[model samples]
Target chain A: MKTEMAAIEIRNLTYKYQNAEAPVLQNLNLTIEKGEFALVSGPSGCGKTTLCRCLNGLIPHFYGGELEGEIFVDGLNVRETPPAKLASHVGLIFQNPENQLFSFNVERDVAFGLENLGVPPEEIRRRVDWSLELVGISDLKDRAPWELSGGQQQKAAIACVLAMQPSIIVFDEPTSFLDPLTARGIFDVIAKLRRKLDLTVVVVEHRLEALAAHASRLILMDHGKIILNGEPRKILAEAAERLSLKVGIPSVILLHRRLSKLGILEGLTPLTTSEMAAQLRGVLNRD
Target chain B: MIRLEDVGYVYPGGVEALRGVSLTIGERSSLAIMGRSGAGKTTLIKHLNGLLKPTSGRVTVDGVDTRKATVAKLSRKVGIVFQNPDHQLFAETVEDEVAFPLKNFGFPQDEIKARTEWVLELFNLTRYRKHSPLTLSGGEKKRVAMASIVSWKPKYLVLDEPTLGQDRENKLRLRELFEEFMEEGRTIIMVTHDVEFAAECGFDVALLVDGKVSALGSAREILSNVELLKKASLAAPQMAELFLELEGVEAQPVFTVEEAERLILSRLMSGSGRP
Candidate 1:
């Protein structure tokens, strides 16, 4: 039964930052199954970051907020557990990669978490090497964090979390500071990690087109509540519902819908350019 | 017009942020500066407003050397709204935040008040003028920042990643505002990752790679070059990529849905009957 439990479960979660007028998150209930990659997107000030903070025991414990919720990470109550203890179960990556990596070298930065947990020196070395290799930055192991490119820096940040071997990882707008092309590469790395590790991944992002195909689920948030959550393609396929809600449907998805409306396209909603091209070929009366 | 003449810049810690970057922006025109993070987009824009001096070359605005002028003097000709509004905002209220720039240019009290109020109303930030800037959302804070610098109505306006944190709706509103601004005969330059926004804006793009200008041309011409954009760590807009990926289709840089639809129609209805 314990093994069959969801990776994360939240019930009636309501939280307000200290000295703030209203709760940023309101009466939210969400359950992410094990090994699911969920991309959460919303306008700023919509509690996307606050929700991520809750999972790593930062909301009630670190931020000192008025929290009314039961958040269980792998069946352990996040509030009851200290952030330091819960950190092993759930890793958090902030928006700015610069602030997250501070060690002299990439290798040291990734191993910093393992060291704090009192892992054996030999085991720490092996895991640190493995994480660096996993992120494809093993060649940069000795380089300073500040010297790396933004995408590389972010990968180093992710490697830092991967070394801890957390079951659940939540990224708060990981590529907000990156260019679209580099952002696409980062998403590929994350999607690959999700598949290889069987890790439950949650990424809060606004760059939709690049990540939509890589994501299994999409959750739209507004006014601190879940407005829509379902399979990524299905949620994105509803142009009228999404537009009324003010979601930035990816241009590719919107193009597909527009073509479909004009009777130019039919069948499944395409989430990527290649998919849309395939649909175009089908419409040409070709196989 | 603004011109960068073989400009090169090196940060204090010896980081060569820009090297041999030569470019020009015509009067009352729009250009979108784009590249990977740390590719010196901010460093290049800073030179336009005299925020930074070129280490090895020259930058001129209307034939005036930037190195000969102070930032205060250059601000009258060029105004820059930096990335991250919170870093540039310090006033207790949005009103004060918007008023500071006018006061700096030494405008008369009444004129400052008039300009500030007008910009606040124009930017739809009049309601938030009394509220703390730190308390505002990302979109609201961005509006407040834009209202402040734009109050002076500088000849050239430079924005670094103006749409970075904004949602699509807010981005649409900002785009309309910028279009209006350009229509008033003021030059506007923006640094962004929003390829669709760049394409819609129909900007002359300056693509930077490794701190040097790699390519400069119209958005469609430069952005549609998949090999070129990839060298700079960029990907063309999804729709444009679709056109490029589909075999037998010509190299048409269709970015927006309308352009994509039109291209599809030409392919389908015009004797091809393709989807």
Candidate 2:
């Protein structure tokens, strides 16, 4: 059940909605270990969301589809287990916070998930406070979820899921609606949570520059399959063209590519701005 | 020609969203509004097109007081594309979605058809003209939303987070589209958190913080101001950050990636040994 074992294992997974003519995900096999920060990215309809749903037991439980293949989460078969049973081990935060938030105030919203599991009142109270503090929104506990800003509401939503103390957390474009500053703050909170709790993190995002520095492994999916998966720097360097085809590479990556083409940057492929600056410094100092 | 005079807005729940925010947007110029989630950027943008009436003070577009005009009336001068495409799109087909606004403005049938065709072509949505609005991808939905407002040809366009779901190539295309609009003498005010987009689009920049105008100047001035950007909870564009970290050599913050490359190449060509 720990991260040393596979947190999630998918084999030959293929799924198609009842109304769809073609499969959204096709013959996909992937393994997600515990305590790893994994980033999933692909084109809009490339089945990243569908794949995440399968991993968290939402495929057969929440959504009915022509599902083929086996999926396991935390040593349990997702097909056999309902989401209610898996909720304690895997937490899913959707793209839009409005869809997930139903409570009146921030505190009640964070406690709602734990309450559904029939947790003790005292334990629920403790987890709510701890989750709010983890997401850095304990101060807004009294405010209505609707009254909060888009970023604050997203934090509250994350806190709600965190209160359940899931071993693995999956985020589907959590920062898509947020402004840049708030997006950075949310990523910071994610980093803090991953380190403090040693939880497995998987996030699907289009904005790579923001997530690149923090992700331990970057998985690039295209047309319902994983095209690239490795250390962020290695996959980025090896699959630059495919990535560009899928979601379009970030500006920083393009710059690094251009520098490499001109023979200015050697060996090291910088991913973040700070890394790029350091590379430039090394180049200048060598001269 | 867009002007705000001591504009202050307090929501019905008594939360002060904007406080004494006053600024001017010139004709045919692009302005980028940067802010945190609660910095009141959306509130300020709503005033441009009369979506929200100021609780105190005044807002005028092209010398006409906004308080005296309705959204439909002001929309002729100001077209606003909201953040969520779902909130603005109601028509079944993409063509109908873009044409609805034109029909509401009472344009002739032929004119609506012509304008819809032109805007669809501009956004590369001509292929999906007959497609259902619900069936489009997220980036395509954003384009349709933009096309819906732009078909009206408002003199000034205000977009809220236009590039939220866009890929890099689409983002580049959007920059080109904004440039074309500027060339046509249409003013553009965009609310965005993508500092890199702000820099590449060649727009003057404004930082909104705590419901007030924290900093306003050319893109070079605002992007290079690390202290000001940090105070507003904004990250500088990668090029700007790189330039800030470089030692000895002096250069204005390069806004675009191409410009940054050019700056580095020029420095190397000149044989400037100073790091």
Candidate 3:
């Protein structure tokens, strides 16, 4: 029965920050099955960060907000659990890598979470090495936080979350500060890790092109409500029609949309450059 | 025009961020600096405003040597918007924030008020004029940071990663704003990792690799070169990649969706449409 439970379950969730005029998230309900990778995105101030806080027990516990609803993570009710305990089940990586990583070296930063959970020294050491190798940052284990580049620092941050061995991971625009190549590298690491570990991952990002290729589901939020949730391709095609949504449609899909309107590649939307390229070759080769 | 004569920069702790980089930026021109995270893009822009003096060479903005000029003086001609809005936004109200720079520049009270209102409307920040800048969202705060610097209307506007947190609407607005600036004969220098946005802006590009200018040219020439882009740890725009993947497509420099569409339509017309 426990194995059949969903990785995350939310029901009738409404939350408001302290001294706010109205609720930030209003009657939102979502369920993410085990091993499902969800990409949550919207304009800034769309309550994506607030939703992330609710998952790791930060809303009712740390933020001291009015949380009226239910959230279950790894079969544990988030509101009933303390953040310190929830840290073991759900890991939340912030947008800024500098905010979470404070230890002198990468190895120490990775070990901090396990140490706080009262894991023994040997276990911490083993977990740190395993997570560092998982992210391919083992060579920078001895380097200080400031000594690493932005991409390297973000990798270290992800390694810190991985060392906790959580069942679910939530990233809040982790690649917002990264460049195209570096951001792609971070996304590739995430995709590889999810495959290798079968981890349930939820990411909040505006750069849809980088993450859409790997996401099993796409969740679009607006004005604190889950406006659209479904397959990435269908949702993106729908989003393309509604200009008011202001979601950044990947360029390939935009090109696909343009070609489809011209009676070419109708009813087909490609997400990646390669996918669009293959389709373009078919159109070009046709005589 | 701004000129860098063999400029080099090294931080206090012995981090060699920039090496012998010599380039000349013509007046009324736009240049987008693209590179990896630690490739010294920020360090290179800082030299323009006298924030970081060159260690080995010289930087001159309109014939004024940066080393001899104070930041305050250089700022009058070069207004820089930092990457993180929180670093520069410390005002009680968005209106006051935009006016602060004008006041510092010794604009008359009437002119300051007019300019503040003008820029507030320009950024669509009039609705939040009375609100504290700290209370705004990340995107609004970035706009306020931009409004503050732009209020002064410096001859050279420097933006560090202007598209970091912006949405689609804001990016479109930015394109219009850059066009308006260019029409006024003002130069815009932006440091960014957004290759697509840079391509849309049609900016001249300088690719940095390990604090050295590895490649410099028009956006089409620099961004369309896959091998050169890889050297800077970057990739070509999606459209360019798409056309490149289609063998013998002959769309050598398509960077945006519109450009790609036009190219594809032409190709299809020549190919006599799909079967």
Off by over 4 Å in 2: A1-5, A57-65, A241-248, B91-96, B106-140, B248-251
On a 0 to 100 scale, what is the lDDT of residue B17 in model 3?
88
C-alpha lDDT values of all predictions: 0.83, 0.82, 0.85
Clashes of each: 2, 1, 0
Residue lDDT tens for model 1, A25-94: 9999999999999999887557887898899987788778699978888878888887888889899987
TM-score of each: 0.90, 0.90, 0.92
Which ranges in model 1 have alpha carbons more than 4 Å from their true place? Answer: A1-4, A103-107, A132-152, A239-245, B92-95, B107-148
The weakest ten consecutive residues by lDDT in model 2 chain A span A241-250
lDDT per residue, candidate 2, A85-156, as tens digits?
898989998766776898889999988888889999999999999989877888999988877776778888
Candidate 1 structure quality by residue, lDDT tens digits, B14-61: 779898999989987989999987798888888998889999889999
Return the candidate ranking by TM-score, descending.
3, 2, 1
lDDT of 2 at B114: 97
